[model samples]
Target chain A: MFLETVLLAQRELRRNVLRSSLTVLGIVIGVAAVITLVTIGNGATQQVAEQIGSLGSNMLQLRPGQGFRGPGGASSDSKRFTLEDAQAISNDIPGLAAVAPTANASTQAIYGNENWSTSITGSTNDFLKVRNWDLDSGREFGDGELQSGRAVCIIGATVKKELFGGQEPIGQSIRLKKIAFQVVGVLKSKGQASFGNDQDDFVLIPIRTLHRRIAGNADVGGIMVSVRDADAIDEAKSAIERLMRERRRIAYGGQDDFNVGDMREIMSTVTGTTKILTALLAAVAAVSLVVGGIGIMNIMLVSVTERTREIGIRLAIGALGREVMMQFLVEAVVLSGFGGIVGIALGLGAAAAGSVVLKVPFVLEPGIVVLAFGFSSVVGIVFGFFPARKAARLDPIEALRHE
Target chain B: MNETPVSSNNNGAAANGAAANGALIRLQAVTKVYGTGIAAVEALKGIDLRIGQGEFVAIMGPSGSGKSTCMNILGCLDVPTAGTYFFQGRNVGRLTQDQRALLRREHLGFVFQGFNLLGRTSALENAELPLIYRGLPVKKRRVLAREALASVGLSGWETHTPAELSGGQQQRVAIARAIVTHPKVLLADEPTGNLDSERSREVMELLTALNRDRGITILMVTHEPDMAKYAARQVHFMDGLIDGRSTEGGA
Candidate 1:
């Protein structure tokens, strides 16, 4: 009986092919929009997480301020950390893998006639270890250079490309603000960080050289620390915080002047924002599903009215009320089901194209596809019930008599 | 009014005798009103009727004379306002709408003036509709529909839709649909009204054959006297009442 009703519904839909197609158009658009929006949103979130993750593994940054309030805060009296403080933390902390006290200044570097404005970072060889960076060529600062405060520096990949052009820069001299420094090594390309900063646009020099020849201060801007084990990050952070408080001579219950930020916390903040945006866009897209359902209901009602005589004939031929209802309901389901299939295909294609344009990972969520399809079928049923009931409740005599 | 029995052939005679005293359809003081109070129109007014099993009866009247209302009540398509109706000894007046539909589904067949086959549907599927409602398997229903179509001389026209066939062929398809379920009674309302003279004769002949050979009781409503001549007995309605009856040339 069910199969026969389905056949009947197919015939009815086939009879009015144009009208049926138009009716299902709304559902197709709604499902496709929902799936495509969600897919792109998921891809964006994944991209954000991956970009943040590439900054460093199990690393933390301690800055001379409370939280992320920039360098100036109410604790203006707080003292900045120096190379000695970095040495103390490295010696005192058990799980410490590398501790580098870094200070940066924006200056122009001159290589013969080519001069480019770039930031210069002053740190020891441990800076590369803490930042998870590597050199593509050349060697790190030798013990002689670090101890004697020699004018020696390593250029990043971007700096190498800008200053050297196609020429070799090893053992070559570059002038930074009237001070000449020998290029000891070149760093590998690290690409852009999550915050959209170019990591390879800086030159690294020894802390002693940067303090004595440039900034003329022993103050370190921040401390970058890498934990020996991934699971020991929290312990390392606590140990470092306690040591800093004790060395700074902070009274008990007094707030520490320094702030320690984990890489994972920054990653979560970025990913969380993307997730919220994705959900908001997806919710807006879901409203169209309801609109599509309303379209189905409207068209079904018109169909029932138009086929009054046909319904009358079925009833007179001894079809039960529910049977007639089933036929119409089945027609509705078939329409929405077809729309769902077409929508899924279109959504997948659009999402793939969108991912390419947006430069994000193409993520296919099978669960959402199934959910959208199932929800469309449910929409058919919910919207179809009213028209089917009206058709079922029609009086055979009056319906037959209808011209 | 005379209650003479009319038999068209020897087979019809024996079948008619068996059903002569058994009323397959009985109505007592049946009244159907269309609306409420002053705006109401009584379509059927205190109608009393009796039709025996295997009997071929024709109901004839002009527009608004209640012939169609009487046919509707007999077919269980509408309920009477103030009367009891019995079909095969069961009180149909007390039956719910769904129960009435079930009774029609199991034991009755109907033909309409419009040759009301579903548009865009083939003849065989139209014929198979009642059996489909009966929940018969597709194979069995198809076989029965083929036999019914062949019986109506439409064996090779099974795949033709109503719009693709001539008026005569469409009426034949409607007849095939009516008899496919082997119903005990067939109710036809102006079945030949839309056909020409020749096509009308063909449809009437088909209805007569089913009544004579299969012993299926037939009740038809029509306005044309020529169409009424095919039935063994004739009942006349005037102003929502059964005015007279004639059973001339009957068994």
Candidate 2:
């Protein structure tokens, strides 16, 4: 019986190959869209998470004068954090990994005959440790460089690639703001961070060099603090808050005039936003599957009306009503199964193409492929049921009489 | 499933004397009325029939004389409004649709006026259809279908579809399909109605041979007296009633 039905389906399918192919095509596009969108979204989110994780997970940034106002009820300047505050935090905070007070200024760096414009960041050696950065060559600024406020500099991979022409850039002097600074080291490439900024585009110098020689300002931008353990972030945050409030002489019940930005909190926010966006995009793609299912329903209805006489003949020949129903149901399932196969191929192709275009890794999840195929079949069964039942319920005598 | 028990040829239950003559079919006062109230048309008005085993019977009537309706009841294609139809000692009127289908597929084979062969099907496949419904293996069905087609003088024409065959040959294929299941009775309604005279005679000869030589009971409906001559018995119906009955001279 199964063989006869298979032969019947094959014969019928062969009779109208063009029509069957067209039906399968509808399902292909739907599955392909779902796979491509999901893969690209997944790849992007993975990239962001990796970048965020590579950064200092236990690090927190302390900005002075919260909400653009001072504790004295006066409008505060954005650059309210000072070198003195940085020193106070370093001295007061226990279980501290490292503290770096950073101030940045965009300036031009020049060698003997080469010149390049880049952002010059002034900070102590602790800046590299707190930011989870490592040097590829030479050494960091030592006590000698810091005591004399020597104009020594560390360049990033991009600056290395540009000025050094792929050569080893260690121990090479580059002038910043027309001041000559010895090249201490080249930092390893960190790629692009979650904030879309190139982590390797800046040159680092000592804080004294920037405040005394370049910017001539004692004010600091922000103090980055690396805690000893990531699990102690909450305790460290409250301690830092209390210390800063005391240092600034804030009354009890008064909000601290500063913001503590934890990397963990930022990571949660970033991932949460990405998950919502992925859902939104995936939901939009699912609508197309519904459209594809409706297409199956429409075609199956047409097939039923066209094959009324054939149905009558089978019924007269002792085929039970359920048998007739199963044949059509199986045909619908076969159609969707064919569509699923083609859709999987299309989806893989789309994902491959997307990886090249988006410049991100291509991830083909086995679970998603299985899900799309299963969903397509369910769509076929759910939508194909009505037409099959309608055909089964048809009276054989009436059907035989239909022209 | 051939569940209807075949009555023993030696049984002497003659309490219902009409059933004693070894009639394979007994229709007692069968009536089929279409619609209800004043708009109703009585297709068969209390039809009583008894056809014996191995008998080639023809029911002759003009159009609208309840002949086709009687055929429908005999074919088990429709149920009677109110009557008792004993097919091989079992009450067919009380049987379910599946039972009727099983009885038709196992005990009775049909040939229609239009030679209702599936258009795209080969002669062999058409012949094998009944066995397919019977759940026979493919190889066995193929072998049986080939034998049935060969019996109808259609050897080596198994692969030819109906459209490719001549009218006589198409009817032969239909006949092959009917006899493939080795049914107890063959029911044909104007089996040669759509054929030329030469083809019609050929179809009639095949039916006559099956009835006489194979001992298969045959019931045929026709209006032509010439067609009725091939049967062993004739039943003339008129105005929704049997007008007369006669036996054909031995061939």
Candidate 3:
């Protein structure tokens, strides 16, 4: 019985191919818009998480201010962390893997006829360990270099590409702010950061060398720390916070001047924003689905009226009321189901193209596809019920008599 | 007119035979009123009717004479407002709408003056519609529909749609559909009203052949005396009441 009804529905739809296609057009556009927006949004979220993950494994950054507003913008009353503070934290804090105090100054690096403007970072060997950075060639500064504050520097891949072109940069001399320094190593490439800054566009030198030649001060801008075990991150954060508070001589009930930011927190904030945007887009797209449903209802009502004689014939030929209703309902569902399939295909194609343009991963979520298709069918039923019932309740005598 | 009153014999053997070939449709004091109070029209006013099994009866009346209303009630398409209707010994007035539909589906077939075949559908599918409602499998439905179409002399026109066929051929397809289920009673409302003289004769001849060959009971409503001549009996209606009836031959 159900199969017969379905065939009847198919025949009826086939009889009016143009009208059926036009009726389903709204549903197609609605489903496609929802799927495309959600797919692109999810891809962006995944890309953000991946970029933040690439920064470091189980790392935290401590700035000498209440927040990361900018360089040299710390609270005037707050004291900057010195190299001693970094060493103290490394020795005193348990579960600590590495701690590096970093200070940066933007300067022009000159080598022969080539010169490039880039940020110059100064830190100990532990900076590379905390950042999970590795050298492409050459070696780190020796202990003597650190102790005597030798004029030795390590250039990042961007600096090397800019200053030396294709030439070997190792054992070469580069001048930073008029002070010549030997390039002892070249850091490996680390692509763009999550915030769109080039991670490989800087030069690294010993902190003492930077203080003497560049900044002429012993103030460290920030501290980068890595925990040995992922499970002990919270413990290490509290331990370092307590030590810094005591060393800086903060009284009881006083807020600490420095702020520690976890990489996980940054990752969550970015991903959360993307998720909210996705939900909002989906909600707006859902309104289109409702509009599509209304379109279906309007067309179905028209169909019932137009086919009154046909419905009457079926009813007189012994079709039960529910049978007539089922035929129309099946027609509606088939229309929306076809629309959903075409919409999914179009949406996925658009999403893939968008992913390439946006430089994000292509994430295909199967659950959304099923949900979209199912929801479209439900829309047909919800909107189609009234017309079906109206058709079913039609008086066979009057319907047959209809002109 | 050869008129014979209903026999009153109470013999057990005769009663069994009479019951076996008894009235397939019986209406007593059936009244159908349209609207209410001053606005109401009595479409049927206390009609009493009996159509025996295997009898071809023509209901003849002018417009608004309630012949169509009688046909509607007999076909289970409408229920009487105040009366008891019995079909094959079952009280039809008390049956629910679905039950009446089931009775129509199983034991009755209808032919409309408009042909009422679904447009754009092939003659074969139109013929198979009743069987589809009967829940016959596709293979069996196709076979039965093919046979019914052949029986109506439309053997080569199975795939032709109503628009593609002539009026006579379309009426043949309608007849094929009406008899596809081998219904016990076929109710045809103005079966030949739309056709010209030649096509009307053809459709009447086809209905007559179906009755003679299949012993299928037929109740047809027509105002044309020529169309009424095809039936074995004629029941005349005037103002919603059966004014008179005539039998063509002695039983």
Q: Give the TM-score of candidate 1.
A: 0.90
| Per-residue alpha-carbon lDDT of candidate 1 for residues B1-251, written as tens digits (9 for 90 to 100) | 12323332243335545444366776778899989999999999987666877889988988999988888889998889997677877778889888999999888999888888888889999999889888899899999999999999999999998889999999899999999989999999999989999999999999999999999999999999999998988988899998856452243
Per-residue lDDT of model 3, residues A66-117, tens digit only = 7544323444446788988888998888887888889889989999999999
**Residue-level lDDT tens digits of model 2 in B172-231:** 998998899888888888898999889899999999988878888899998778898898
- Model 1 regions lying over 4 Å from their true place: A1-4, A67-79, A107-117, A144-151, A172-181, A208-218, B1-21, B245-251
**iRMSD of all candidate structures:** 0.9, 1.9, 0.9
Candidate 1: fnat, from 0 to 1? 0.81
Model 3 segments more than 4 A misplaced: A65-79, A105-118, A137-153, A159-185, A209-217, A251-255, B1-21, B245-251
| Candidate 1 per-residue lDDT over residues A1-403, each given as its tens digit | 5766677677778888998888888888888888898899999888878866765668888887676542112234468888888989999899888888888887999999999899998999999998778989999999889877799999998889999999999999999989999999999998765445678888999988898999999888888898989899999999999999998888999988988888787777777888898888878877888888888899999999989998998898888899889888998888887778888898888999999997778999999999999999999999999999999999998888877
Which docking category, incorrect, acceptable, medium or high, applies to candidate 3? medium
TM-score of the second chain, each candidate in turn, equals 0.90, 0.91, 0.90
List candidate 2 segments past 4 Å from native. Answer: A1-11, A56-85, A92-96, A103-122, A135-139, A142-153, A159-186, A192-195, A205-221, A227-264, B1-22, B36-39, B223-225, B237-239, B245-251
What docking grade applies to model 1? Answer: medium
Residue B5 Cα positional deviation in candidate 2, in Å, after optimal superposition: 14
Higher-scoring candidate on TM-score, 2 or 3: 3
lDDT of each: 0.86, 0.81, 0.87
Q: Predicted candidate 1: interface RMSD?
A: 0.9
